[model samples]
Target chain A: MRNLFFFIYRFRAFLIFLSLEVLCVFMLVRYNTYQGAAIFNSATTYVGYVLEFQSSVKDYFRLASINNTLATENAALRAELMKYKDIEQTDSLNKMTDSLYVVTDSAKALPYILHAARVINNSIRRTNNYLTLSVGSEAGVRPEMGVITPGGIVGRVKTVGKRYSTVTSILHSQMLVSAKIKRDNTSGTIRWTGGDYRTALLDFVPLHIKPAIGDTVVTSGYSTVFPEGVMIGTISSVEREPDKSFYTIEVKLAVDFAQLSYVYVVEDPHREEREKLERDAGIKSDEP
Target chain B: MNRKFGFINIVQFVLFVSFQILFMDSLILYSTAFCFIYVGFLLFLPLGISRVWILLLGFITGFTVDVFYDTMGIHAAASVLLTYLRPHILNLLTPRDGYDTSDTATIYAMGWRWFLAYAVILILMHHAAVFFLEVISFRDVWYTLLKIVTSTIYTCLVMVIIQLLFFSGKRANR
Candidate 1:
């Protein structure tokens, strides 16, 4: 017994090192996977507060660009509103004489609800990138909700805190977005292989379909997270490798991840119902 | 081994960690070279500190940085490896008269040549571990290699500059 104690004492440093390394690796593997809630992420209260403070300080420098994007988005929204106003006037005139029409819940008619949030912290250089948002459960942001900017899709919320949330950015290696070509409707998956933040690879695009450069890729809406027809990016390059069945297409992402400040979190109201129904039907659902 | 954790060391720890997660986290050069200045704090710890304490401190520091970086344990794993190898590297590069109890692993204390070799090897190992563990695959070997090499050089350059600017050669106890 004394001999064993001596042995342990002699190599205590190595033993400690091994155990700590094992613990770290355990945490790495455990938290690395897409799970319900993460404790050590930036969305934690203190870390979120610090990051929010830092972003608040840095935000001053980006006010000009933020204002520019906001103005452009406002103009686009105003034009869209004008078109909708004319449609509403004609529709209401027709419906005014029709007293037999049954009233329906407008909220139920809308499949998705958007919540605006400010990005407090973001990183693009890591293998798995994540963004911290200023809104969380308090603002109806929850896990698995898709995040998007006016330019394009950003990512999906991974975890949520009281007043903060963390998003798994589209730039993450493990993150895959179901996308389709806007022109021919050829469907594939968009994944970011490390190296460049502005680009990602669209896999499973069969070689039979001739995808040209500048072809727009948008969400397929096959998943419950992102709504269909949201812009992802344009195909910059398509390579037909020898013996490969699919063309390796590169997409230039629309949103500039580096300058991201404001984003909208999309919440699918009917996601649980659809998912439960699919689960009951024994159909496997794809991750967001 | 007998030295205690000073108030200055605690302050330095907080400063190093905060600076890393806040300022240095965003400062990436050319998209490939990342400046992990927090490694400097781990690298320049007092030589007299025990290996066990060093290892624990490394884990704590890396874990703290990991939280803000949202990488969970990658930083901690790399840092523990770095601290584990620190003593061995010091033994390998021992000076003629050996190290003083008050000596720090700084450029001023150890000279530019020794400091460079020490910093490069340790930083290279840490970066390799971090980048490889991050990707968890050998798929993008060339790009990962480029990142490790560039980040090592970038981190080493920054550490050296920080050492020169902040850490002076004069030891008050001596």
Candidate 2:
């Protein structure tokens, strides 16, 4: 600071002259009738002309904090939405609670528990495609729980880790779900030949059912893998082989695999007990 | 011991400021040329006054004229600039015999030729700064320049006449 004073003193006359000149310039612009407006107009345009400048400035500075807060809120909202969504998608028939009827059926209206998770990694190009999720063992997501999007069925939980989980997406060649035609209750197995994301193959529907285009196919609830009435898609096209009695079904998939963002893990807490009882009773059904 | 020179300097500073603001400000010629005899105060400052004091005195004198003329800092800025340039002008006009600090810068003391050159240069630079700042644009630079030159000569003429009337015989010749 002392050095600054010395340096200033050395050039004091010129510095003083320069300062006075600057002061004069400022006053001239500030008070001059003609130039004042011109100067301010130019200055405002040069500095303030950027559209959304106020929001950009505020957003730029607080973006990180805002992002973190929004992320947390979104997580909470998604979890709540997924819970309600699980209730919305599950068959109202299966969730029935009537005290008048004695409990006699094994599939007795088991409540579905839902946990929201985001797709961390996914593949639709492979013959055997798998979807990775953000939730893992820490989120109570285990192997074999069904994962689904808001549109329709996604896949079953294949594996679980502390930080993430993988779902076998329905687009995989090996993935097959027991699905039924809502129009006639004709049950069939839905599969993917593994090329397109929009269509899946529905096999084993008998020719007598006469399924039409745009008929919604839903889960048959024949297996414990998925609950009844979860939408798979609609029948897009039907073809018949010259020798076969079954219809070759092409289903327009409801869930767009290419644009998948979030999925929910559907949990039935009584699934293990019911499967154990079924095994003990030797009531084995086609497991696929 | 030279109370006479100090008293004349004060009188010159006050009278030059008042006369320039009162009579000269309204004396605008050609909508561009303006009389700016306030520069005469800076011109009459004692030779070899430290550049800092010269600049300060210049700013004060011009600021005084600015208050009356309502030109804000225009006169002050020009005055300060001319004040800093004074030493170079004096050095350029210095005779081969060198300058006598005690002699002062009146025409009688320094000779009419040296005094005119010194005063004219300072007045020209001051007028140039003042008018250019007042207009604050270069759109009519040639016209502004004409005003600067004309005002410079008019200021020099007034200063020289003042010098003749104020300084003569014994004191300047001493």
Candidate 3:
């Protein structure tokens, strides 16, 4: 007993370190559990309230840009209505009208594919850029959901709360988004090169695949995180080496990440079902 | 004599937290206000404060900030680390026997250079721990070192500027 006590006393700091390490490990292991995630949900709402008040003052400067966006959207809606009218005679008029009516009626169009949120807190200088959004889990946000603005794809949802969510911007090195060339079906993964926020590197495209500058890239829909057809960026440059098997393409993001503020969180209705299937498949494969 | 500063500390916490959540959050050009509060609280604790109190303060400050940022317990863990390190930092700089209870570690008590060194070291340590914790928080080690260095430098610079401005008022009065 004396020897044991002496041993513990000799390394008191080590024991403390061990205990703390254990606690941290426990917390980390239990992190994804519902209780741990719910805490962030509540905190985000509180933080959102504080940021909402602060942005209300600075929001004036954005009035002009927001007005321009609204005007453009309004004109596009009008054009869409005209196009529908021209095709109304040829197609099933009532079915087309039902689809068009939802968007044409301004009241129902308030919350569409993209939801607006004020940026409460944002960090860009860090290699892993994270932006705090005013919207949260209570607002229908979930982890792995894609966040975007009028400009382009911003990032993916890292965590969500009742009234706020943290978005990992495309500028982050960890952001791996699948994108495809607009002109051709060739697709590759997009990741930031850590050199410029305005540009990203597209990897895994074969050298045989032809790609051109100024070609648009959109989400490939492989991951349920983002819906198909969301704009990613345009190809700014392409590099091919004789020995290398893959062509590396440089993409200039469509969204001006530096000026990002308001954004939307996209929810994939099939995510839960998809995840369940993947998990079950893995378990069955391991059973043999 | 009553240790009347409890309410004052709470008020400071509220004000600093409010500043972080509101004004500093949206401003990507500068560091967030929570960084200031983290350093500010460290400066406010009286000389010879107990270790437990320091740990408690660190945990609360960090947990609250994490709650806002949606980072879970990362800030809390980092804050606790800062709190544990502050006394050691003070010990390293102003040896306990040499410190005067009435004089805080502000610029007035310690020269600008010493204050700068003190605040810079603490802020760097805090930011480094936070960046690493965040990286490990999700189990993704990719670009961990890069994130640590960049965020630490940015957070440290912002912290230094904020300390200079906020503590200068006290020095000016002195």
Leading candidate by DockQ: 1
Clashing pairs in 2: none
lDDT of 1 by residue, A176-276 (tens): 99999999999999999887899999999998899999999999988888988999999999999999999999999999999999999998888888788
Tens-digit per-residue lDDT, A23-117, candidate 3:
54455446533332344432356666765666666767888876787677679889999998889867775775445544664323432355667
Estimate the TM-score for candidate 2.
0.42
Best by lDDT: 1
Top model by TM-score, which number? 1
lDDT tens digits by residue: candidate 3, B61-173: 77676655545566676777777788788788974468754566666666677777787777777767776665555444545555555555665576556657666665433
Count clashing pairs, candidate 3. Answer: 3
Model 1, residue A126: distance off in Å is 1.9
Candidate 1 chain A, poorest ten consecutive residues by summed lDDT: A98-107
Ranking by TM-score: 1, 3, 2
**Chain B TM-score, candidates in order:** 0.94, 0.89, 0.76
- Docking category of candidate 2: incorrect
lDDT of 2 by residue, B26-56 (tens): 4655444556776777777777677777778
RMSD per candidate (Å) reads 2.1, 30.7, 6.6
